[model samples]
Target: MQRKVLVIEDSAVSMNLVTRLVQQAKLMPICAATLTEAKHLFSQSNPEEFLCAVVDYHLPDAPHGEAIDYAIASFVPTIVITGRLDEETRTHVLSKEVVDYIPKENTQVYDYLSRLLARMEKNKHIGVLVVDHMRSSRTSMASLLRRHNFETFEASSAQEGLDILHQRDNVQLIVTDFKVPDMNGTQFVAELRKSWPKEQLAIIGVSSGNSALLSARFIKSGANDFLQKPYCHEEFLVRIMQNVEYIENVETIRRAANSDYLTGLPNRRHFFYSVNHVARTSPALQSVALIDLDHFKRVNDQFGHDAGDKVLKEVAKLIANHFSDHNVSRFGGEEFCLYFANVAAEEVDKSLESFRRAVRERPIRHQQQDIPISASIGVTHQGRKNLDAMLAKADELLYRAKSSGRNQLQSDLLA
Candidate 1:
């Protein structure tokens, strides 16, 4: 079901702007011009259907943030927007348990709100760990994190935090205090850096001491960021978001570097790295297969390169779906590779035959034309020796398959 965002505003200009932003975020906008109308609309709808409520701080019917109170009371997260940038208004908005407030002074704040909406949706899958010796501190931090839809974990000691991290693989951020029974904040961060690189896990050190060097020490020890105690709600949330985004941005770059630009499959370098990692375990049986599209250059010669690219993409999709359990990759051009561990020779041969038949039967549609395609596969199921030897052997068999017949599976297994 599509989640809805309840937008209550009196100004025509602001209402239109907020509505567009909500739609751009891929959320349904439920608009109300007045507090009474908002209440009527909300009473008829399910509260669980709403992702959040964006309310005007000064409404015609309910001035002085009464609409904000109503939205919070209705169990929906509230975000306030107003032209008033005064200290009093900011304090009043912050006093309420609202998610965050946006100043309507410029267009840039609306962009921030858009990012906040996206983060709220994504945070549901991200886990955050809060480590503090005091239960009250841990609970307070966890409560604020929960409001943003983050899955939160609480640990009272450094050792407990490490244990929780080992058990839960989804944790991406850690917020720890400087004082703990087992280790201080800098020491704890140093210990964590031994295994978790900054690109994979984000850590923020918090301290209330008067020392000016605490933040620097934490950073030197591999913490991504630092927060001083008595930090405001907005500042704290911004720091957390920045660190999480840093790790996410690194991951995006790494994936682009490792994936094929044409088909979005793993490139040859990544394929070699993955197979070698698995080879260390030395399974009882292993198989390698090299697949090549038969007469692929003919398609590009008859149809344009665009049509040929479409065909390759379609075949890549089929390979992904067919061999989801095995390690699969697209070695440049029309060739692909697959690695199977711990599978018998007979079963491997049967799987390859099935895949060959599938490729021959399915025709790719391109430019209103049906482009027929087929693949020749060569498979070797010898015991583990080395990846290079197996790949060379598979290549020799692949040459034989293409020589004898175009669309066929040739394997060393006798059947």
Candidate 2:
């Protein structure tokens, strides 16, 4: 189901703009022009159906933020927009635990809104670690991160932070203070680099000392960025978002390079690299399978390349589902490769037989036509041979399977 976002703005122009922004983020917008309508809509929604909400501080029915209060009471993550910039207004809106307050300056309002939405969407899954021996500092930073929807973990000292890293591998960002009980911020960053690189994890150092050397030291020690103590909330958020964005972009590009664009399976290049890595790391016997679709050329000849693509996708899905735990890849057109690491010898044949039966029994439907697909598979188990030799043996057996009959399994071990 598409996620929905509630927008409560009295001004027609602002409401229209907010709706467009929500649509651009690919979220369904439930727009309310007044406080009464907003409450009615909230009453109608399922608690889990709405992702978040945006509310204007002044509405037709409730001018003093009643709409924002209602949203907060309903447990919705709210973003408030207000024309007022007084301290009292800011304090009141923030006290309600609305995600953040956006000023109605009209110059950068929508830009900040879009960024917040994007951050909230990604933040729910990204884990952040705060390392500071001072309870006050750690609590303050963790509270801010939590308000932004980031999953937070706290560590009192550098050693504790390292232990937390081992326990929670998904930690993507670390905010550490220079005055930790154990190692200082710079030293902690250096130690962390031994396991996590800049692309895999981002570190930001915060220091109360105004010395220029502090920032320089942290940056030189592999920290992605640094923060001065007593920084404004906006500045801190921007720095965190920027570093996290960089990591996300690098990861996305890496995945694109390693994955097949059409079927989202590992591409041929990644397949070779992973197989060798697994062979070197795993001691248990590994099995390699080379599978080729039998007479796949006929699908394109009969139904065109588009239909052939559909069939290949369906076949890939079948293979992935049948061998969900193994490393499976698209080894170029009409061919795929599978690597089963640390598996028993007998389990290899059993798995392949099940996959073959699934392929033969199920036909892909393209344009209301059922197109049957079958594959020839060959398996080889690692003995004293290397990965390259095992793959060669598998390919050799695959050729024999095709030569004997189109849709069959052939392995030297089975003989």
Candidate 3:
């Protein structure tokens, strides 16, 4: 179900903007011009359906952030937007358990709000670890993280933090205090760095101690960022968001490098890397198949390159769904590859034949036209040999399959 965002704004222009932003984040926006209307709308629905509420600070019905309080009391995360840029107002808004507040002084703040909404939705899946010897400190930090929709894990010591990380693979960020029974913050960070690199995991060192050198020490020990003690809520959230985004941006780039631009399947280089890793296990039975789409060029010539691309994508989707348990890749234009491990030759042959029939039976629909497509596959069931050698045999067989006729399977076993 699409989650809802409760947008309580009195200004016509602002309400329109917030509603559009909520929709852009793939959320449904429930709008009300006043707090009373918001209450009536919210009462009619479940609070769990709301991702968060974007409330204007000075709603005519509740001018002093009463709506913010009401939303928080009702267990809905609230974000305050105000034209009041005074520090007093900022402090008052932050004092409440709201997610965060934005000053509606410029259009840029709305952009920030958009990003914040997106992060809140994404944070539901991202786990954050909080490590501190003091129970109060750990709870304080974890509570703040939870308010933003992050799955939070609490650890009282560095060792406990490490253990939690070992058990949970989804943890992406760690906030650690300098004082711990097992190790100092810098030592703990260094220990974590030995296993988790900066790109894969982010660690932020926070200290309330008066030592000025602590930040440098933590950074030198491989912490991604450092925060001083008694940090403001905004500063704390900003630091956490920056570190998390850094890790996420690196991951995005890594995935783009490994994926095919058109079909969104694993590319050839990634295929080789993955298959070689599996090959190192030396399975008793292994097979490699190279698949080439038959008459693929004719599709492009008859229709256009766009239709040809669509056909490739449709075939790629079928390959992914049919051979989900096997490693599959789209080797550049009109060709794909599959690696099967520990499967009998007969089973591999059966699977390939089934896949071939699936392709021949399904016509790709593009631009209101049905475009027929088929694949010629070459299989090599040479067990536990050089992957390149297997691929070479498969490619040779593939040539033969194309040579004899199209839409057929040729294998070295048959040869």
Could you say which candidate leads in lDDT?
3
Over 4 Å off, model 2:
64-66, 83-96, 104-111, 282-284
* Candidate 1 deviation (Cα RMSD): 1.9
TM-score each candidate. Answer: 0.94, 0.92, 0.97
Q: 276-368, model 2: which lDDT tens digit per residue?
A: 887788666888899999999999999889999998888888888888898899998999999888888688888898888889999889999
1 against 3, candidate with superior TM-score: 3
| lDDT (C-alpha, whole model) for all candidates | 0.92, 0.88, 0.93
Over 137-196, each residue of candidate 3 has an lDDT whose tens digit, in order, gives 999999899989999999998889999999999999999999988999999999999999
Q: lDDT of model 2 at residue 167?
A: 93
Instruction: Mark the regions of model 1 whose C-alpha exceeds 4 Å error after superposition.
Output: 301-306, 366-369, 383-385
Model 2: how far is 376 from its true place, Å?
A: 0.7
Q: Considering TM-score, where higher is better, how would the candidates rank from best to worst? A: 3, 1, 2
On a 0 to 1 TM-score scale, where does candidate 2 land against the true structure? 0.92
lDDT by residue for model 1 (1-415), tens: 9899999999999999899999999999999999999999999999999999999999889889999999999999888999999999999999998888888999899998888888878899999999999999999889888888889999999999999999999999999999988999999999999999999999999988989999999999999999999888999988888888888899999999889999988989999999999999988999999999999999999998998899889899998998888899999899999999998889988988988899889988887899999999998887556999999988989999999887988887852
